[model samples]
Target: MADEEYISVEEVASIMGLSVRQASRYAAKVRTERINQRVLFHRDDVMEQARLKGIEHEARERAATYQPKPTKTDLVPAGEMLEYIRERDRQLAEVQAQLNQALLEIGRLQGQLTDHQQIRQQLTDIQSERDELKQAMERARPWWRRILGHD
Candidate 1:
């Protein structure tokens, strides 16, 4: 086959409006290149296949009038995008402030709990000391003798 006569499977598929597999099947000859390891098919065979399938005219018509869909990045202006970013930053700052306040409240509650625990331990110790003193006094003298100040 002549060098100018052969076309890649991808180009054949695009021109004939068919998948690469379908184009490969329809093409007359599949050529393999050793240098780049590329596959190519005959252009005339692809065109003949499209004509036989009665889609050649339709494919050309579609290709002539095709328009790509617009994307968000293309439609949005730069100033509005900047404003959206600023609004997001403001919301983030507000959330951060709330988190800090919650942390401070947790610390204060923990300190109060520690203080209450210490007071409870001191009360327990005082009760035990009072009981010991009462036992000593009772062992030394009877109740009536203690009331009369006699040992």
Candidate 2:
């Protein structure tokens, strides 16, 4: 036992190009010893088993397809992000100003419409009063004068 070398499960994982969990399962198929609540396997035995199972080829294939995640350094800087936000806010404010201008124009047009309606109503009232006064003047005039067609 002293002459032979023992490797930890983590070392077996690295050697087999497997994750720790996969390495643990693989180690169970071979001879394993528990020491200090940690599983240890003979490195030579683990490598031989991997060669027999053709796992080394699969590990190589997985590595070829692996892509690491992007880190914080890959992101846009804080100043650039703040500038983009400010630009968007400026565009939004311009749109809001145009909307407010349209609202003011609509209010002005509505005021003109109200003035036109009042003017129309006053014209109608004036026409009614003119008709009443004409009728009263006709009644006041003598019937003989109307027959003569004189004003």
By TM-score, the best candidate is 1
**True lDDT of residue 6, candidate 2:** 71
Which residue pairs come into collision in candidate 2? none
- Tens digits of lDDT, candidate 2, 1-151: 5424676666666667778788898765777778889888875687677778788666445434545445576687889989999999999999999999999999999999999999999999999999999999999999999999887
TM, every model: 0.52, 0.48
Model 1 Cα lDDT, one tens digit per residue, 9-106: 66666777777788666533444333277676655565566677798786566445545446678888899999999999999999999999999999
Candidate 1: count the clashes.
Answer: 0
Which residue segments of model 1 deviate by more than 4 Å?
Answer: 1-65, 141-151
lDDT of 1 at 26: 53
Prediction-by-prediction clash tally:
0, 0
